[model samples]
Target: MDGLAGIVREAGRAGDRVGYFAALYRQVTVEVRTAVHGGLFDDGARMDRFDTHFGNRYFDAYDAWRRDQSGPRCWREAFGLLDDPDTIIVQHLILGVNAHINLDLAIAAARTSPGEAIHALRRDFLLINDILARVVVTMQDSVDALSPFMSLLDRVGARTDERILDFSVRQSREEAWYNAVLLAGQNEEEREATIQRLDIRAAVLARLIARPGSLVRPALELIRSTENDDVPAVINHLDNAMERSSAKQGTA
Candidate 1:
């Protein structure tokens, strides 16, 4: 079985997290289709609708969707297929990291001078746009996986409800940071705003894990293992959040 560290690195390669996410989006979508068409073990029929280059069919679909509909709704509907809790958590992190890439591209476009850098930024923006569309589709597939389990859980009483709540909180904070950076200038104000937005969630998660007799060390170690980058900091925060949630679970 793949561990979280491997998963994080796999999702962050080639200095282009968006590309990593695009690959993951396709993989997860295939997995969902396999699960839906046959059992989880069967090789499902594949759909190559969004399999074009970063700018061709993929970007076209993304532009049409952006013009025709809302942004977050598309993702909420996309990954809603996956029924497994661990997969859903993984999807959340994937989506969050992908969102960060889009925001990063937007910031670069907003700040740089017109030249080769501008051309590169434009190219990057289109790629990011395609990635966003793919992520939405992938997220919808995950939602499908979660649907069947949701009803059973509702009937079976609260099971890991706190963990779900914690995930939601972290997802929101990640989204907020993405928005702040994407919409604002690349100046100090923008950095401060994004860092502040992320800080709130980090503080909450730290407190949650710092409770009496919590399993904070392993998670902290995991966070520390992540290489020095923006992605690593976010992973560290989530690790802490998970640690806190686990501690709370143990006490309960």
Candidate 2:
């Protein structure tokens, strides 16, 4: 949790500062491992191995002096979350969009079409969505953790605390930027863009849920019912389906 906390702290830094998140990513894996015990992990031996492997891959990359050379490529994908709040919000919206894709992929795979080999492509898309969702949650948590600071800045006297005011102003700007892009409702252009995004998501969901496997059984069952009419239930059902799939597949 320390590492995770560290990452969140770093993300709250001034917007002008780059590489803050990359540094945080380098450290977060360590904290994540520390948070997991033998009960949460596979076992002592397997956990040890996981710790070592993750350390080498993630830590080494995080430590790299050059973004292209030394750091883990995964961090590069995540760093944008810190740079812009709008991107952070987009990340969450994309999850809902991707869930739509998962549903579409599942249906598509079940259809048994023979035009082209979409199975692999759809699978890849679903996997990417799953991965990105985790990243989005991390970013969301980081930003949420900073909300108190935002409120604090609003109260501080600008004349007496110029430096703090400057910091507050920057944070306000960053947060506003993120909210405008992410939390704001969709305009026609944005909605149209989202529809295109939905197509890709649908393709992936169709591929994954096409089969009546245990991994997606819950989701498939829910879809078969009228429960998807409730947005919260749909999200919960999807989250449950993914969790079950991860447990079955031995994913950490």
Highest-scoring model, lDDT: 1
Q: Indicate the residue-level lDDT of 209 in model 2.
A: 22
Please list the C-alpha lDDT of all candidates, in the order they appear.
0.36, 0.33
Compared with the true structure, what per-residue lDDT tens digits does model 1 show for residues 69-170? 433322322223222222233334444433333233233333432223333333333433443444444443333233444334445664332343233323
Per-residue C-alpha lDDT of model 2 across residues 81-134, encoded as one tens digit per residue:
333322222222232223322222222222222124323234332333334345
Using all chains and alpha carbons, the TM-scores for the candidates as numbered come to: 0.27, 0.27
lDDT score, candidate 2, position 232: 32
Off by over 4 Å in 2: 1-4, 13-42, 65-74, 77-86, 90-252
Error of 2 at 182 (Å): 38
**Candidate 2 displacement at residue 196 in angstroms:** 30
Candidate 2 global lDDT = 0.33
